[model samples]
Target: MFTGIIEETGTVTGVIRHADLWRISVAGPAVSADAAPGDSIAVDGVCVTVTAPPHDGVFIFDVSAETWRRTTMEEWRAGTRVNLERAVTPATRLGGHLVQGHVDARGSLTDRRESGAAAELTFCFPEKFRKYLAQKGAVAVDGVSLTVAKLTRDTFSVAVIPHTLGLTTLAEKKPGEPVNLEFDVIAKYTESLLQFRGTGERELSEDYFSERGF
Candidate 1:
């Protein structure tokens, strides 16, 4: 799991495509400082395992066709900057919400502009995932955990601080750029429980509605 907090910026050194698989190499200093074979790393919010561990601050990961079909990494070429994060340990503080490093869906950047002190980034989520979004809810855009600032039928927005742009590949995002998105898993579970409740309209478990625990 990840915290959706970017640790370092890595640059693509090579992309080797071999039929159904592609091997990508990136150079990251902090994330690769103690890296080893079989470790997991988050490259632009997508969890990839280390096939060739960092040698001189470089790491390599193999991407299959399934991953290519689901993420923007297929569009990556040499010199592309990517967000990199090593998996957090049990002792690490949970600064951000739980991130599975699994990309649920891909979103396209529909609009971007400066909103006074911050940048307003709006991404259009497909209709299938629209139900998972809500105003002020959590959304992971390219590994960065951001709050949903606005919501529309097909679009949602987030306010990006200057530091966010500087620390991750989101700074490179422009119109039409595809980003990996993971909605809050808690929301999904909550909605499912609510739907089940609404079906039978079950009564309270205990004297729960006694006005502040009675």
Candidate 2:
């Protein structure tokens, strides 16, 4: 798992297409410093395994046709700046919320405005994921954990600090750009459990709640 904390920004150096498969190379110093062939890396919030050991600060990953269909990978090209984060270790600090590096859905930047010294970016996401979002809740946008500053029926906004803007790709983001999104895993799990209550899989009812003193 990842912590939704961007360690560095990587640039797509190349994209080689072989039929429906794509082999992508990203060059980043910090993320590739100790990366191995089998290590997991979050590239723009999508967990991709390193195809081989780093070569001159670059790592390669293969994207299958199905992964391409489900993500914004089709929009990526050479020179695309992407957020990169290595998987978290047991001893690592939880600087951000737990991130599976699994993109639940894709969103697009709808608006951007300056809020004091921060940039407030509003994004329109899939309507089905709306129920998982709440004001001040955690959400991963392109692998960067951010709090929901505001929420609407199909949109949410986050205030990006100058530091965040400088260290990651958000500084170069513009309106209408596609972004990978991962909603809070806890919220999704809770919703699933509630939906399956008393189905013999597990009971989640008044008795269950009272037992837990909820």
Candidate 3:
């Protein structure tokens, strides 16, 4: 799990292609300072496990075919700048919303409006994800947690303050650029429960609650 608070920006140093997966090396000194093999890190909002120990602040990980198909990993190459965040620990502060580092879908920026140092970005995602989005709800874009400022039938807008712009990659984003998107996990769970209830397969009973100590 992660808090969607970007620790630092990393640069892709190498990309080795394999039949089923691609090995990627990223240079992030801050996030890779104490990272070890098997540790979880969020790279551009996707949960990738560390494959090897850090070497001079560089870490390696493999991206499977499924992950590439679901996210914007295909666009990654050497010199690519990516948002990086280490997995949250028990003592970690929840500075941002709960982020699983799981990308649900890929979206592209459709418009960008700047006012002084702030900016409002609009993106259009798949229609299926529309049900999970709500005005003022949480959304993670390229691993940066932001609140939805406006919602339309197919697009959503987020306001990026000057602080966030300097800390993350949002400031460099341009219209038509792809980004990884993860909607609020809580909303997805609630939708699943509602659908399950409507199925009438099995209803939650007092006995069930008692058994689980709920």
Q: CA lDDT, every prediction?
A: 0.87, 0.92, 0.95
TM-score, cand. 2 vs. native: 0.92
Q: Identify the runs in model 2 with alpha carbons over 4 angstroms from their true place.
A: 198-214
Candidate 3 stretches greater than 4 Å from native: 209-214
What clash count goes with each model? 0, 0, 0
TM-score versus the correct structure, for each prediction: 0.86, 0.92, 0.96
Query: Cα deviation in Å at residue 37, candidate 1?
Result: 1.0
Better of 1 and 3 by TM-score: 3
Candidate 3, position 164, lDDT: 92
Question: Against the true structure, whose TM-score is highest?
Answer: 3
Candidate with top lDDT is 3
What does the lDDT come to for candidate 2? Answer: 0.92
In model 2, state the lDDT of residue 188. Answer: 97
Give the CA lDDT, 0 to 100, for residue 149 in model 3. Answer: 98
Q: How well does candidate 3 score on lDDT at residue 214?
A: 88
TM-score of 3: 0.96
